[model samples]
Structures are given as structure tokens and as C-alpha cells.
Target: MKYQDLKAGIRSHLEDAAEDFFMVGYFLRQISENALFTEDGYKSIWEFAKGEYGLSTSSASRFMAINARFSIDGGEHMAEKYIGMGVSKLQEMLGLPDEELEKVTQETTVREIRAMKKRQEAPRSFYGFPKTERPEGSLLTTPGCGDGKYDCFSCCRECAIRQEPRHCRTAPLGNPFPCTRVNNEEWKKNIAYSLYKDECQLLHPELAPVREGDKEPDPCCLNCTNKTCFNRCDVAKKKDEDEKKQSQEELRKQQREAEAKRPEPSDRDIKAFYDWAGIKTTDNITAEDLKKRYKNAGGGGGRGAALQDYTGSARGIRINHKKELTWVQIAKRIKEIQEAEKKKADFVERSNGAQKNVRDLIKQQEEKRRIEAEEKKAARAAAKLQAEAEEPGKPEIIDGDFREVEDEPMDDPAQEAAKTRDERQEPEPVLCDTCEHEGECAGKKTHENGCMGYEEKAQELEAEAEPNPEEYARFDVESILKKEKGYLDGGREADCPAKFIKEHKILVDALTLLLEKMDAEGGAED
Candidate 1:
């Protein structure tokens, strides 16, 4: 094939691919809308596309979006108008408005369409003028050009050429033109006057100047030499006079309406005013005197009334002077003030009482903590004393003096040997003195076979002699004694003294027996 044919073939394939992409988007939209993918054991169309066709979620979503945007009948089918436009152009045209979209053709490049869209979305200048250069209080509703269309540059040009005669020759050619008036030297450099001059010459060739235009033109060009045409113009003077007269007439009408609405003072108000002024009676009170009194009370002469200042019990109270209040209104306001004050006073008293209660509770808690700390200190001291008393061979405090008790002297080895020999030489067995069968037994004959009665008695003694470790582990003697002491000191267990004593005795006996057993075992090991 020729190179041109190859290019043509590639273009054809691209258009076909775009059409195929549109079809895929249409099918995806169908699957998503009808949930058809659920029948194929897929949770969603995106999941189904990814699993079956290896399509990414983003690509699937883009395809669906393109179908929704460009397809006919809400993605049921593709529109024939966009058949050969290709996907790239369609994507770029997504943000274009309907009017701008209609302007796009197959020949229109994506960049041109994008630029057009940006220009349309860009903000227009404020009334064809820069924000900083706009005049304060200028009318925002000024008419546009003679064609009634709001082109920013055209509107500004029309304003300069028609409304402002001074800026006609120097008006700039863009939107947001400078509002400052140009001097003669700057005007000569301005290009707007050249364009205006050319237009004037084209329209009015007969009036075109040979070289120089008028140095100082009149308002009406007919009187070119006269500089005071504006001052002498009857039409302009009449318009100004008419506007002034209308303004004055409106002001007078407003004043008349306001005067009609003004309320007259009643007999009650007059009496109250007299009382407020400290006058004896209203018999001799002149109108001048009443007016003076009202003015002194912050009343105004006309519509611009000042606020009235109250005196006596309602010192800080102020009411509008324009309002014609009777004595009843003033009295009611004073009563409200007094009631509010009473409530505030009650709240303050309650706050003070609450503070006092909090202080008292804090004092009581501090006292309780101090007493508990003292009790704990006393308990530690008592435990120390009890431990010292139980310890063997320790010095005892007698009359505030420590006195060490001397150890018992050890027996001589010779003496111990002699004692043992003496005991062994005795022929007769020792009598079972504490046995119950003592009176009935034949002394040595009954003891020959280890004396069953004596043996029974010995077993009873052995059973009682064995030390029980469980008893020592069961009772924490010092802790129990401290708790009992605390109860006695606090007067909590007054009626339970016998129970305390019994438990104390059992703990002490068990502790003493455990110590003695431990000492005996040490001696045996030695």
C-alpha cells in the first residue's frame, strides 16, 4: 500500500477503536444500571470487568462516565454525531457547556476548545473597570452600548466616547481601562484618539480638519470659538433646574407626612411631665415652660429626637424621646428594674451561703484526715512495742531505762554425763503418772510389752505436742492486734471486748508455740 493509504488506514482504525470504546462504555453502563453482573457471581460491574476482561477500575469508570456524558438515551446507545470524533476530543469536551459544545467540529482541535472553555469561565472585569479605579457611589445599572450587549471592552469604549467627553481621545482599548483622566501630553500618545479620529473622518468627511482640531471646543460644535457654551445652554440649564425643584418638592412632602404622624400629648402625659419637673400644679404652666421642661428631659424639637434620661430611682434608664410614654409605662419599667435587682441580690446571697458551706465541709474533711493520720502513727508505735516484747533476749524498758537480761548459764559436759548415767542405772521403769489406768496396773509387768495403757497415754501427749504451721500462717498476729487496738481507740468495738480477747489469746498462743517448736528443732539439729 502507499504511505497515504497507510495513514488513512490508521485513521480509520482509530475511529473504529473510538466507536468500539463507546460500545464498551454502553455495555458497562447497562451492566451497572441493571446489576446484570450479579448473575455472573460478581458484586459489581467494575469487579466483573476487572476479573473477566482485565480492565482497571479507573478505566472502567472513565468508560462509564464517557457513555453517560456523550451517549444517547442515558448510555443506552451511543450518539451518531460523536461517532468519528475520537475519545480524546470527547473527553476534552466534557466540561464544555451546551452552547460551546455546539461550536465544536471535527476540525476543531482539543487545545482550541479547551482555550475557548477557559476564556468563557474566566471572570469579567467589574463593569469594565478596575476595582480600585471605580468611582464611589457610581451607578452599577448604567446602560451598555447602543446594541445593548455587555461586551467588556466595547462597553468601556462606549462609556469613554459618549459619557465622559474628556476621556474620549485617550480611552484605552481593553477591558478594565484606567479611570484616571489623561493630560494633553499623555492624550497625544494614546492610540484610542487615532482610532476615533479615523472613524470621525470616515463618517463626517466634510468636517475633518486639515491639520489641527479645535483647541478648546464648545459643547455644541456649531459655536466652535465659544468656550462658555455649556453655561449658556438653555436645555442643560432647564434640566438642572427641573431636577432641583423636584428634589425640594419631595423633601417638603416627606416633612408634611412626618408632621401629620406626630402624636399629641394627653392630659396624663402633661401631668406626669409636671410631676417629673417638680412643678406644684399645671394651672399656671405656660406652653413655653412645658417645652423647656421637655427639652431639659432630652426631648427633641423635631423628628430627630434624642434619648430621654431617667432620674431618681431609675437613674440609669433611658427611653427614646420620640416615644410618647405615659406615667404607667415609666412606673412599669421601674418595677421591672427593681424586681431584677431583687433577684440578683438573692442570687448573690445564695452564692455566699454555698461558698460558706463548701468551706465548712473542707474544714471537716481536714479534721478527719488529721485524726486518721494520728491513729495510723499510734498503730505503728504500738506494733513496734509488741514486736519488742515478743523478741527473746532483748533489753526491756524498765522505768524509762534499758536493762539487758542475762542469758542462763550452760551446763558442764561432765555434769550432763553424770546425770545421764544416773538416770540409766535406775532398774525400775518410770511410772506413767498421768495415765488413767495407773491404779489398776501391775507396775513393771504391765509396762513390759511397752504398756498398752502407757503407750496410749504417750500417743495422746505426742499428738498434742506437734506444731501446726497452718495455725501460724492463718493469723497475722501483729496486724490483727493493731486492728483491734484501732477499734478500741475509736470506741467502735466496745461491746465486743470478750470476742477480741479470745481471738487475741488464740493468736498469741499459736505464735508462742510456733516459736518454741522452731527453737526445739534448731537444738535437735545442733
Candidate 2:
């Protein structure tokens, strides 16, 4: 058939299918709404459709939704304009607005319609404010009210009224409007009061009372007359200023007490302390250097005594003394501590050296004793050998006959000859060297005797010496090409014979080239 005719026929069939889908959706809607499935001995429309027409639950739901969205004349018929569009395109267009539906045409694809719908429904800026900053219950976008107004404040008030049924604390029992009374203390304690105060400050800034020193009206100022008046108010402002001044004075008093309790040393005090302590000063004298000097002095005292002195009349030396000492007294204490530590360190060092000397003396004595024991053992062995060498043959009674048994010396010629022969012979190979049971084998006797593992290893070595038939079969180019050619010939009746033959020939050529490259590589290796 000609291509245009074929395309026309397919298009017509697609339009007919679209019409059938719409009618199906309309009929399913009617059946579901009326519970007409009960007449067919089914509990629900889903069961009836599944049993009679093989429609699944999800498919039935989609059909019902489509009918509800695109049906005309109370779902008696579908809109004729959507008949040519496929079911998938119509379903994608369902999310689009009524006005946007006009943009869809016969050429519009399902994916394009889906994208358009997504763009339309994408979340907008929350009422011209960031989503995080938007108030709870506030509309995401501006919505028209019954009176054709788009004021957010009014809408928020209405939303608040609907969500919270409580009346204001000062309002009459049945009053529906919000309480406008502003109390600064209440603003801190009550959420509704704070929100109302903020709303008034933001929306009606002109009505806020101004203070004397403020260049512009303070939006954060407390309201006194229910946001109705804008008179200059200074009583609250004056009281707040006085409280602030009092707090500052109290803070300064605390700082002074702390300073008096823990005073910092001046430059003169530091110099005097260092001089009395007999410590040299430099531009870069770190705490670490001081610590090293203290260690070298062998200082032995608690930290409190090293850094402080007692001024109490009852004490020659006080434990846990506070900072009652002057700089000179502190330096004197530090010098005494350093001298005591130095003496202690010196005594400890001398004691350690004496202990080391004693240990060395003990080690030398043990070595002398050990040498004497070894020498005695060697002398005894030599005496035994000499006695054996001097001894003659002794007669022994054996089996009713007198026999002579000769004693062998440590340096016997016969034993020496046997040792020489052993040294001259080459070592035997380990029986388990090539055995599979190597580590677990009993011994050389087991390996040499009737071990099946040894036999198997020998056989494996022999097999390795010969070429593998399976390996040759795997790389046999002629056999592989013949098998592939047979497959191509067999499939020729199912597909175009010429096309099959061409593809088979191309595969054969690729295989041949691969084999030739492999042969070249092998030859280079050889």
C-alpha cells in the first residue's frame, strides 16, 4: 500500500478508538453512579466490570474521572472536539485549565500537554512572600472573595475567625470581631494580642503614636487607644528609658566588684615580682619556659603555695590560701618552693644512680657463676671421655658363652666415618612437595606408600603436558563459522533471506579478523 494511504487508515482507526473510549467512560460512570452492577449479582461496579469486560479497578476509576471531567449533557455524550485525540492525550489535558484546553490541537502530543499542565500547577510565590515567611492559613496566591476584593488582611481575619472560635478576652460574649485593645504586657503573654499588634503596626503605621526622640514613628511601640488615635505619647517611653538606665548602672556596679575581687598586676608589679623571684625577663617569655625553669629547680610544693602566700595572723603555713599576698611575698614563696624542689630532684637522681650501680654489680656476679658452671660441666665431660679411651675390653656373660664388649670413645673412627658419609650424600626430595595433601599428609612414608592424592597429582602433571581438546574446540574458527552459518540459513525463511545472509557474512568477517589478530599476538609472544 502507498504510505499516505496507510497513514490515513491508521489515523481513522485511532479516531474511532478515541470515540469508543469516550463512550465506554460515559457508560461506566452511569453504571457506577446508579449501582447498576447489583443487578448482575455483583457487589460493586469494579467487580461487575472485571467479571464481564476485564476492566481493572484503576482503569474503571480513570474512566469515571474522565467522563466526569469531559462529558457533556450530564455525561450522555462526550465533547466531539476531543474525539480524534487519543485517550492518553485527553487524560493529560484533564489537569489543564478550561482556557488552556483550547491550545491543545490534533498535532499536540501527550508529553507536551503534560508539561503545559505541570507549568500551570507549579507552586507560585506564596502571596508575594517567601514560603517560610507566609503566615499560617494564608493563601498561596491571591484569591478573590465574595465581594470581588483581594485584600490579604481581610482574608486572614476571616480565616482566623473560621479556625479559632474563641472570642477576645475583653470582647463581649457573642462578639465575632477581634479585640483591638493593646496592652504591652499582654502583647508579650498572648499570641492573639501579639499577632493583632503586629498586623496593626504593619498595615496602619500612620495611626501609631510617635515618641519625642524618634525620627520616624516606632512600629514596635505599645498602643493605648485601640489603634484609633495617633497622639504623641511619652509616658511609656520615659518609663522604659529610666528602667534601661537603671539596668546599665547595675551592670556597671557588678563589673566594678569583679575587678576589685580579682585585680590584674601592673607593669611595675610584674617587674618587682620577677626581680624578687630572681627570674630574668625577655620579650618572649612564655609559660612553657617558666615551667621548664621550675622543673629544673626541682620545685616541690602545691600550686597554691607556689603562686600565693598567707596573710592570716594564725598561720605559719596555711593550706588553700586565697590571694591575700603582695607581689614580693608571692615571689619569696615561689623562690622557696623552687629551692625545695631542686633539693628533692637532686636526692632522687643520686638514689637512682646508686640503684643502677648495685644492679650492675649483681649482674656481673651472676655472669661469673654461670661461667664457672659451664666450665665444670665441660671438664667432667672431658674426664669421662678420657676414662672411656683408657678402658680395655670387658668380658660379659651372654647365652651360656663368654663374649667381649668393647667400649666406644667420643671420637671413635667408625662413628666419624658414618657421619662423613651422611654429610657427603645429597638430601632427598620431600615426598609432599607435589602432593595435593601437602600440609595434612602423615609423613614421607604415607606419601611414598599408597596415597591416592599423590597418584592424582602425578596424573594431573601428565595431563598438563598434553594439549586440551576442549580448548582447541573453543577456538576452532571453522567449526564456529559453520554453526553460525547454519543458524542464519535456518532463520532465512522467517526474515529476508538476503538480509540474514548479509548480517551472517558480516559476523563471520568480524570473527575471522579477531582470530587473525589473536594469532599475531601469540606469534609475537613466541
Candidate 3:
């Protein structure tokens, strides 16, 4: 077959096989072992996984490793040993040989397998030595085999730990190799030293450096629980002393900065302090003196003390209090203050509500009194109008018909008597009776005067007469009494005795009738 046809067919088969994890692992093993993708211009399996198959390098590598361990001689089908096992279980058991893994059951978990493996890999002796040689693909890398002569070069120059000598790990843990300097020249000078001391002393103590007096010295400082050698080692002791001195210097520097930032005491604070000490002073006291007095009195000794003392004295008061706040305590204090403010606000609101209620009640009572007063006034007015309407002899129709006419001067008795008889007798129709101004004036000579023009007077009399049942019921009793008195005192003005006698007889009859009615009503009541 042509190379292109073969390649296409293989790609097609790979696409199908890559669907499952184990199948993909099988394909990966085949592709990597034969370097099949190299012909397609891919450099390695990682390139093939990324460029062609679209798989991550980590995922592809993991599949390939699993295929090698789970399959029989890297076969297409997974071995019966771990067919139903989880991927993680298989990864953990990968260190075991195929024969040993085949004995494991599907019921076994990954954690149990890992624990079993850890136990198997544990040191068998009490000297903390590994049960086996280091694994081929270990993560740990000990440069120059922990030799002190190894040159750190550019890597160490940029290292923060190297810049700060206090951060060096060897100061506390101690060096592993015989060479004491920054380089491993002492181990290189003796070829046997390099070969023997290649491993950590804790694991293989036979290769450790020899001491003068002790038959068997400690392999590593970390293994020594007593730590008695910390004082004996000159390097550890000197580093410890340097660290303590540096820490003290740093503490002093911080204190100096804080003291510089501290504010000067105010005038009130100065006066209060002087007063408390029973010393007469004023606001002119120097800041230096105040600070001295504050410090002597234990100022800045603890939190919240820079502003005031514990005894509620305002002596050492400062602008800012040196108090450290924790969130829990701040929240608790804030809640307490909020509750107090809420209580105060509620009290004010309730007081205002009560006042408003009282004002509203008073307003309602005043309105009620006003309404009652208005009702009473209206009732009294209505009663007075009713009494006026019921009064007898009250004028209803005053169209001037009942008014006395003005008399003309009369020296002759016969002419006066004729005029009086005409006036006192029944009304006579005038020759100009049809005149529009007729009856406007009460005088009999209205015709001769062409009728006085009194239109408004006529209208008022008509309006007043319209509301009553008896519009013309007025007796004009006062005019009749005046007439009688005039007749008794100066005789008749016109000498009409019959008319005067008739009026006297009418008055006597009316009084007798009124008396009889009153007597009858009184008897009925009794």
C-alpha cells in the first residue's frame, strides 16, 4: 500500500480507539514504541498528543503509563488484573508487578492500596533507612549531594534566603556534607568522601563525618530530640545571637517611629494633668515636659492608654488612641450603641405621637363646641322669627291704604265736618281711579295731587303681605285709642260723635269677649 493510504487508515483506526481511556492508552503505547508519528513530522509523543490527537501532554502521558502497567506486554486489551478497577487505583498499583496486581480484587479502594504500598516502602530498620533504592522518577533532587562545597552561582545570588543570612536553612538544620564552606571543595579533594557521603546522614550514618571524643555522634540535628548540640555548635550559636540582636534593633526602630508619630498633648490635657498632680500650670507647658510626664505615668503601656488613663483621668490624652480592634469586639460595641440610639429615637417618636394625639383630641372637642354653639344660635333665631310671625295685630299688608291722610286747614265747621265724614266713612271711588298712581298715597286728595309716586313702598308692602295667612288682619288699635283720647280731651276734631261712640262700643265689646274666653279656659284647666 501507498504510504499516504497506510497513514490515513491508521489515523482512522486511532480515532475510533481513542474514545475509551484504556483503548487510547493502547494506541499511545504503540505509537510511542514504534515512533510512528515521526514520519508525519512530529518530534515526540507529546507533539503528537497535542497537534494531531488533541490530547494534553499530562493526560496522554498518564494513559501511556497506565497502558504499560495494566496491559499484558502492552497489548490492545487491558489485563484481567485491573479490568474493573478505578483509574486512581490502577495508578497507585502501577508500582507493583503484573503478577502481584492480578491478585488484587475490584473491592479494594485506592486509599487502602496506597496505605499498603506506604507500609511496604517503609524503612525496615530503626536507623530510618529506605527499604529499597530511590525510585527512577523521583521528584527530589539534592544538588552536589548536599555538599557544602557546591557553588550556588547565579541561582543562589538571586535567592532571598542568601541575601538575608538569617533565612539560611543550614543555620538551624546544620550542613550535611563534610565541606564546611559555601563550596564542596573538601569533598572533591577526597574522592572517597564524595562516594561515601552521597546519602543523607540520617538514612546512612556509617558515612557521616567523624567526631573527636564521641564514639557515635548524631547523624543529623533534626533527629536529635534533646537539641543539646545547639549550644555546642559555634555556627548555630553565632547565628542565634545575630538573629536576637537584629530582632532587638528592629524592635527599637519601630518604637522610635511610633514615638515620632505621637501627637503633642493639648491645652486641656496639660491643665488636667497638672491639676490632678496638684501642681499649678497652664497651656504654655512644653510638649517635651508633657511627654515625659505621660511616659512616667505609664503612657503607651497598652492599648487605649495613650488618650486617657484607666482611672478616667484626662491627663495623657492624645489625638489618636493606640487601640487595636478585633472585628468581633467592634461589632458587639456597635450593636450596643445602635440599640441605645434606637431606644432614644423610639422614645422621642412615641412622645411626639402622644402629643399629636392630644392636640388632635383638643381640636376635635373645640370643633364640637363651635358646632353646638352655632346650632343654638340658629335655634334661637328660628324661635324669635316664629314668635314674631305668631304675634297678633302685627302689620302684614301696609300698602298705605290704612294710613291716615294729611288734613287741609279748615276754619269753617261745616266744611271740616263734611271732610271728616268723607274720610271716616267708606272709601269713595275717585274720578281718576284708573290712574296708575292711584292708591299709592293714603290721602283722599291724591287724585288732585296726581297721585304721589311711591312704587317702592307699594312693592315692599306687597312682599310683606304675601307670607302671612291674614295679610290685612291689623286692627290699628293705637290709632283708635288716640282718636278716643282726642275725643275725650278736646271734643271731636270734626264733631263726628256717632263714629266715636261706635269705636267706644266696639272696644267695650272686644274686652268683654276676651274676659269670657279667659274665664272659660281657666275653668277647663281646673
Candidate 4:
């Protein structure tokens, strides 16, 4: 197939590739520590066997293969060929909407990624590495070329052409091998020179400098790929090209307009660092993207507001070409974040409602994560889809292409949500005044594998404690009444411990029952 077609296929396959990585990476990550120890997400078959399903490291490696090979048809390894074509770290190249996050599974967390990075169980025999780290094919020659021995004669001359633009002339035949190579008189030559000579570059060979299934290096680099180099540029020629292209893109246009709308960072107050993506990076993220990620985290799909989000700006952020963000200024910014976080903590401590809302969200998030992990585990095991879930095989579409509109304002909606979750109107868990038992009345399993003895425990604990459980329940009502009024009248403080508060309802209930019995007796006499 043609190279262009292969490139297009690579792009399409990447959508599948990321999911595959998540699947394989997650499984590899899981068995590393306590996977077998947790029965919750394990297969029911594994559970009944009561075995660890223990495997040696080599055997553990096969787990990813087993899952990757999963299919309704059973043994079809569908991902084999497309994975053979090679995947790209193109996901890293794209600028994220500041307001967005992918619909991530539990496997996407940093902790899981940390485990996967230790070793990749990639079967070198099947799929190739995702990042070839380059794009160009052939000798990577250019239209305007020169040749020299000490350095690439091609580069020496390009440097000449750049430094002396008047001296260079366009090749009618279109430049020879490595035609696209820029003249960098100072920058060191790459591996192309240390190994293959003019036979490749001078001759313009058809085969990629790879032979007999050997991996090929990408020619797409800082100088060769003129589009990305900016301040980190080594040569004058590529730098000029980088800036010229940057001004034209529609993305930059929106960026410039949006940045203009917000107050520009003062040189003193708003810190700037080297752009890690090279100079082509505008050091800007769209307000639209951040909101999208935030919404995704909330399990919603809606276009983010066009308003500004100053949350975590990566612009002026210095990261390597690998996009590894490492800079002192970013660290400084993180400290500022910590301080701001402290203020939020203080506010939460002051406001009961805020703390409760945060707690509810945490509970909801944990519940969502538990359900997600269970589904993924089921998918890996090639089990039938769970009836409780929508299914685990949905395609991941994270881009802003699909978004629903919400008419409500963010502030009002947030307030309403906070009130709903944090309002203190609901009753707390019921405790039996008749017992000192923890946990729901033993109708529910303690997960100890026996018939629940909830009533027995309640009565036993009640027999041990002072005051009848029935009287304790009534005391709670009066205590709560006095305590609530104390906030207004400032007369007496009702010291009701959490233990008593919980146990009180049982007493009140019992007293009411006794009174009802006495009334029944009176009615019978009449």
C-alpha cells in the first residue's frame, strides 16, 4: 500500500490503539501488586476455585495477550495487523481543551500508568511500537540540497542557503536525497550520518533505511519538521518557517482572540517559562477544552463555556519534545496552587455544607470507579456483558465534536447541586437503643459468611448498657430539641454524644409502643 494510505490507516487505528493500550496496560498493571487478593473484580470462576490464579512473571505477561485476544468470536486476534503498521504518540501532539478530560477508565489513572511503565509486555513479533518518533519516508532528502563529508554536505549547504539566502538556487529536479533536511552548521548530525551514507541520502533509495523488519527512525524532528520548532530552534531557517506558519492557523487565531479578552499576564505577576513543545507552541489552551474535561469527569457531555479558565495553564510551560513537563516555574505555580488549596480547605472547614457536598462527590466518584473497574475486569475475562452496566465495549470519543447544550448558568446549577447533596434535612442512620451493635440490624450480612445475627447482637449489647434502649431513644429527641434551640436562645447545651444520638430512636420507638399498649388496655375495659 501507498505511504499516504498507510498514514491514514495509522490515524484510524490509533483510536483503537489507545483503547488497546489501556486494556493491555491495565491488566499488566493490576497483577503487579494486589490484583489476585481482591475478589471483587475477579472472575466468579476464579473466586469459586479459591485459588490465587498465581502465575510467574512470564505467565503474568500472557494475561495481556489473553485479554487483547478477547472477542465474541472467541479466538480471533483482530488487532494483530493494524497494530503491525505502527502507532504514533499523536495523542501527545494535540493541544487539549483546558476544560476537558477523556472519558477515562480506572486504567487511565496516574497510579496505573506508573505500574505499566515499569515494563511493557509488547509482543515484538506482533504489533510495533506506537511512536516511531518520526513521519517522513525515504532518504528524507530535500528540494534544495548540498553534500559535504564532515557534516551532511546537504546540511552544510542548507546552512549556506539560510545564512546566505542569495547563494541558494532551487533544484529543478527537486532536491536530491534528504531534500527536506535543513542546513544546521552547528547542530550535530543524527544517526543517519553515523551509519548509512550517500548510498541512502545521495542515491535517494526507495526503501526506508530499514531492512528485514528492523525498526525505522522518524525523520520528523526539530529541524526536519519545520512546523513545530520555535524558541528551541537551533537554526535560523526553520525558526523563520515556524513563526510564519504559526500566524496562519485558525487555532492560533481563536487563541489570540481569547487571550486578548482576558487580562494579559503581567511580566512580573504572570510567570512565563520556555514552551516545552518548542516555539510553535502558543503557550495557550482553549477555555472550551478545560470545561469539556471537567464535564467528562462529571459523566456529562456538553460544550464548555467560552469563558476563560485559568486553572492549570501549560503555556510558558517548559516540557521536552517528549512532553515531559519539567520546569521551576511550573513548580512555583504548583506552590501557588497549594496555597489556594489551603484557602479552600479552610472554607470547607468553616462551612458544613461545602464539606458535605465534597464528601458526597467523593462517594459518588468512588462508586463510579468501582463500577467501571468491575466492567473492565469482566471485559478482560471475555465474560458476557453485565446486566447492570450499559456495557464495556463503547468507543472512546473525547473530542469536542459531540456536545449537548445546557441552558442553566454554572453558578446557579452548582449551588442547586450543593444544596441537594449537602442539605442537612435527612435523617442519619438508625441505631437500636436496645443494642450496642455496630452495622445495620443483622439482616444484612457482615460478609462473615454466616446467617446475620443482627437482632441477637442488638439485644445483647442493650442488656450490657445502662438506661433502657427505649428510654435512650426518647432522651435523643429531647436532647436534639434543646441542642438546636441553644444556637438561638443560648440557655443550655444538650451534650448528646454521637453514640447516644444514634441509639436514641430505638428508645423513643419502644416508649411509644408501651403507651399504645396501655391505651389498648383502657379501651378494652371501656
Cα RMSD (Å) per model? Answer: 38.7, 43.3, 33.6, 49.7
lDDT of 2 by residue, 1-526 (tens): 3333432433453367644666666666666667666776886666765786677666666666676777786565667776677778877776565667889888999989877856763332212211123357866543332222332222222231122222332345465544232223343344344434333542333334443443333343344333332321244455456777999999989866764676444333433345434663222343444444432332223453443332222112121332234334544554554454455455446545755875787588668756766776677679889999999888575767557989566587756766666788844323454473544454554454355586687775564343332344325665566655654554443333366568777877876776677677772311
1 or 3, which is superior by lDDT?
1
Between prediction 1 and prediction 4, the one with superior TM-score is: 1
Ranking of models by TM-score: 3, 2, 1, 4
TM-score of each: 0.22, 0.22, 0.23, 0.14
| Predicted structure with the largest lDDT when compared to the true one | 2
Question: Per-residue lDDT for 1-526 in model 3, tens only?
Answer: 3445534544675666533566667676677667787888986766777787677666776777787767877786787756777667777776554344555788988878766656554322121122223357976433211122222221111121231121233533454323132223442354234432234343234323443453433343233233333222345455666877999999989976886675553433433333344442123334345445543343322443433531212233232343322223322333443444455455446545755876797689668766766776677679889999888885576565556789669999867767877889945443333333545444344344335545554554454332322221123333344444443332232233465446655765664555455466652311
| Residue-wise C-alpha lDDT for candidate 1, range 339-383, written one tens digit per residue | 444554554465457558767976896687667667766776798
Local error of candidate 3 at residue 294 (angstroms): 75
Error of 4 at 520 (Å): 71
lDDT of 1 at 352: 56
Give lDDT: candidate 3, residue 203: 29
lDDT of 4 by residue, 42-146 (tens): 432223112333333333333333433332233223333223221122122111111221322323544443344334442111122221122367564322322
By TM-score, how accurate is candidate 1? 0.22
Give the Cα-based TM-score of candidate 2 against the true structure: 0.22
Candidate 3, residue 488: the lDDT equals: 36
